[model samples]
Target: MTPISSLANPTIKHAAALLTQHRIRKKSGQTVLEGVHLIEAAIKQNFTIKQIIIGQSALSHPEVAGLIEQIAQSIILATDAVYKQIRSLGTGVDIMAIVEIPTPALGVITSDCLILDGLQDLGNIGTLLRTASAVGISTIISTTGTAHLWSPKCLRAGMGAHFSLAIFEQVDYEAILQKVKIPLYATSSHTDKVIYQHNLTQPIAWVLGHEGQGVSEIFLRTATAIALPQPNGQESLNVGVAGSVCFYEMLRQRQFAQH
Candidate 1:
């Protein structure tokens, strides 16, 4: 099969738009998965892959070739130049897939869940998602001001964690707070209560906020405020780092209690 060499090709343009524009992804209910790892994760989760595009040179790669063998339909080939047009910067990925975004319905918060309150950085958002999944947290909710979870940058940062968890985006904090039956905790540098002082074994909701602004006032006022206990005289920790610490603490407590 001849590789698609033109940037004006409809499939190339559509994939490019999906990668660069959140509005196109939202409207089309699809997102682009770059690299073999993300595509593998999507396949493992049984996500509907609409199309696959491979760079001509990547066809020789064992992993890429192996993936190609698994999916028998909807494959398209592109020249290296055309692939470069759609791939993310600094990434040498040669394969990508347009897959339908999973829309998981929010159910009862029976286990530990994470609430993202206005976190704007895609890297931070994605890191927290990866951390949450690593700690076995199954659900995550993002408030209106949070960055798009499925965006290319976020997805790349997440490294396929998006497929393993139930993610709710653009949620209303007030409404979601009402639905959460478990104890709610929020991180605050000003709080005297350190994270280790709290009992985290039980199901709870962790509210992590923006990098600069911190958690929203509603969360600070309503949720139990706790700090990470930085003794180095630092003003604060990165939101992703802070949240990961909290998530692991919860996991530790639960594991200890299980014995």
Candidate 2:
């Protein structure tokens, strides 16, 4: 029942800065989740919740109602107008939470892996992680060049995927080298080895590279490059789509061989 109406409120200003500026989030060691789905996902994933800012209007929603009754975290009550003032920049999301995500380590997360070399699009990277987890790829290690997995855009695009798996962001190739012992494969348009030609039954790291630059020389130095057969003139598979194909293919092989 606490009405926070002042933009000058320290917590409100901090949240506004977090939503508007990336540096502010990193500086403060926190992130903002605007939609109820995203906030609940963070909660399910056990991310540290520092502030739960709810719109007075949102109290009627079932998700918000459930969260208020079950969660012991701090809560901030704001008028609907005040809530909208700090809502995410163009998203129309009415609820928001500030949660702390762990700074990721630079190594192999699990046996089946998805290694992102330099993907920049937060949405693409996030969806890939979501798809990866769905196919039972348990761990993902992203190079420093990719979008931050904990960023709001990536988190939303992930659609709660992080709740079920280990994600390491801001990692380096040297770290990957030490962690992944099984074969590492990279996705490309010009590879000589088609996906079916390779045996994916073995544990492998499917490395999808930069958006336009493709995989790196450093990764290429060690990875066996892989490509989807394109009989038509399709230029390249979108990285997220490409990774999805690779993950399911790996699943198909593993599941079939297991039987």
Candidate 3:
């Protein structure tokens, strides 16, 4: 097959737009997945892959070649120059796919879950997702002000954790407060209650908030506030670090209870 060498090609343009524009991704109900690992994760999770684009030079890579063999559908090949034009995350990514975004239905929170309230940093958003997934948190809800979960930077930072979790984005704060059946917990510097002392053995929803301003007042008012003990007297921890500590503590408590 002749490689698509032109940057002006419709397929190239579409992928570029999906990578750069949040509106385009939302309207199309699709997003671009870059690199071999993310595509592999998407396939493992049975996500619908609309199209695959491979750089011509990457065809010889064993992993890339192996992936190509596993995929039964026709793939578009692009010259190195063409692929470079559309690549978003930087160098060394020669494979990408246009996939339908998974819209997981949010039901009753019967297990550990996460609530991202106005968290704006893409890296923090991704880190929380990864940590939550690691600690076996199956569901995550992102309020309107949070960063886009499927954005290229977030997706890259997540390292395929997105595939393993049911993430609901752009949800209303009030809706979640009313809908979640489990206890809501938030971490705060002002709170006298420490995380280790809290009862985290039962099913609960962790509400993580903005990096600077912290959790929203509405959520804080509704949630049981717990603070991680800082002996050195640091002002506050990054949201990602704080959330990871909380998730693991919950996991540890549940594991101990199981014994």
Note the Cα lDDT for every prediction shown: 0.89, 0.81, 0.89
Task: Give the runs in model 2 whose Cα sits over 4 Å from its true position.
Answer: 89-93, 107-110, 256-259
Model 3, 148-202: lDDT tens digits are 8998889988999999999998888777877798889999887888998888878
lDDT of 1 by residue, 1-259 (tens): 8999999999999999999999999999998999999999988988888999999998889999889888866999999988987788555659999988777666667678999999899999889999999999879998998889999889989999999989988888777877778888999977798999999878889999989998899878888999999888899999999999999888888786545
Clashing residue pairs for model 3: none
**Any idea what lDDT model 2 has?**
0.81
lDDT of candidate 3 at residue 225, scale 0 to 100: 94
* 1 against 2, candidate with superior TM-score: 1
Model 1 has a clash total of 0
Give all candidate RMSDs, comma-separated: 1.6, 2.0, 1.5
Worst 10 residues of 2 by lDDT: 101-110
Q: Write the per-residue lDDT of candidate 2 for residues 154-179, one digit (tens) a residue.
A: 87788889768787777777878887
Best by TM-score: 3
TM-score of each: 0.95, 0.92, 0.96
